[model samples]
Target: MQRTPNWSLQQLPDMDMGQFRQWQALLEERTGVCVSDQRKTFLQTSLCARMREQQMDDYQTYYDYVTQGPLGAIEWSALIERLTVRETSFMRHRASFDCVARYLHERLSQPGRQTPLQLWSVGCASGEEAYSLAIVVEQALIDTGSSKRDYGIWATDISLQALEQGRAAHYPTGRLGGLTQAERNTWLTDTPDGRHAVLPSLRERVCFSRMNILELAQAPLRDLDIIFCQNLLIYFRRWRRRDLLNLLAKRLAPGGMLVVGLGEIVDWNNPLLERVPDDRVQAYVRRDSSESLE
Candidate 1:
């Protein structure tokens, strides 16, 4: 009897510079993510893993297969999911969330503020950031004696697999380190399988959607009260990063805050946004029309 080959153990041939460039261009064109020369091995490994699963041995053939027609589109989705990184945790950046809490306090203090606050979490992986935002908003409302205030969080990512995980709102116990004991007690319920699941009260406030960063211009979210886009721009070219920030600026409501990962972009400015001048966080606020006229 003939032996079936163990594709998992099969050695993938080295990807040459030409092949690397082709794959790199395809990723950037489709996802706005730049794969650097240093990440060549990473790109190769991801491609090889997917190629092995597809029983494809040739690089160019697999590349063509991912770019062709309807079947190619499905394959591309799987390939892109492998390429994207989804590492995240609840309240990953404390200072940034602190900034958000402060902003919420001020907004809630305003007279006749909007009934429901709108928040967006760009590149939200597995829903941690979105749920964290929900926690902050809910706490702020309670502290300010505005418990009846309504709010919504829009969490978006490019990977469908990640979005599904976000929708599930279940996480391993190890991933809850960023949450305080009180927070965990309030927002999480113990799962039978040694995991923590976000309580439905928080989950219902967030809507997870698959969104390609390059296609933000067409997204219908507008006048958002806050936009948290962190640890995402590092994968894109500087120009594309600036372009994405500009589009985000357009989506912010006047006086709305935008937070990004520090050092992600340099010398970037938007006419409608003013730097928040907080040393602890890289953030900006959309200028109110009255402030812009001054």
Candidate 2:
């Protein structure tokens, strides 16, 4: 193990190629996130941040500490939070939520649907997308005269820190940029400190959980009506991207929808699903038996 003198957070030593490869492989194996060579500095910086917190200097030592035993699992959790990007905003992807609203409007309008609408927000960083989804669905039900239609969201992310933030359901004022004044008034209450917190009623509708997308096969809660997974596939390899989609497709209920970022995948075809017609929305719908594309 190579040792180094005391170093400040801003003065991180360069990571050697071997060390980089080790980390890249570890990240991919654990979370399915492919860290390219171009991202070597990013990985180094993230690693250094955690190392500094633990007063650990050598990369190999830090690696061993994070991989050795039970405590290693805890360290891994802390490290993964720093490794994963959590940049998100409420209603950041309007088209996808709009598509969901339209679909739910049509579904709630029909009779004989007795179960509550089920939704899942994969890689739901900081709860914005999940809460945004709740607002959209709630609004759609109101517009369709089905305001009492039951619905809930399962927001999952690989970062426990992010999940904790999501469960807090608090946001700064400008963070809700895409939301209208009316929506803010209806769903959020301004804190004494000038921040905004989601109303308890809205917060109660969402359950946040820590989930790694790579563990899709072992994930609970199937037969979902909507699964919104956006801006996540880019971190994974192409083949793994398809594999994830196949896994996600299995979780969808009949006529359920799967939404991804535009251009994240190319030429991916699943016979059991059909692309949503709206050009503005990057989504697909699970095809039920006897259902044909119009």
Candidate 1 yields a Cα-based lDDT of 0.89
- Where in model 2 is the C-alpha error above 4 Å? 1-6, 290-294
Q: Scored by Cα lDDT, where does model 2 land?
A: 0.88
The digit string of per-residue lDDT tens for model 2 on 1-294 reads 344456753578668899999989999999999989898989998998888788777888898899999999999988998999668888887777788888988878888888899999999989989999999988988898774759999999998888988999999976796888899999999999889999888899999998889888899778899999999999999999999998888888888899998889989988778999887878998988613322
Q: What lDDT score belongs to each candidate, Candidate 1 first?
A: 0.89, 0.88
Poorly placed runs, candidate 1 (over 4 Å): 1-10, 290-294
For candidate 2, list the clashing residue pairs, or say none. Answer: none
Q: Candidate 1 lDDT, tens digit per residue, 1-294? A: 122346557755678899999999999999998999999989988987888788776788898899999999999999988999668999898889999999999999899875699999999988889999999999999989895859999999998988999999999977775789999999899999989999999999999999999999899998889999999999999999999999899888889999998888989998899998888899999988823221
Provide the RMSD of all predictions against the true structure, rounded to 1 decimal.
Answer: 2.8, 2.9
Model 2 TM-score, all chains together: 0.94
> Which residue pairs collide in model 1, if any?
none
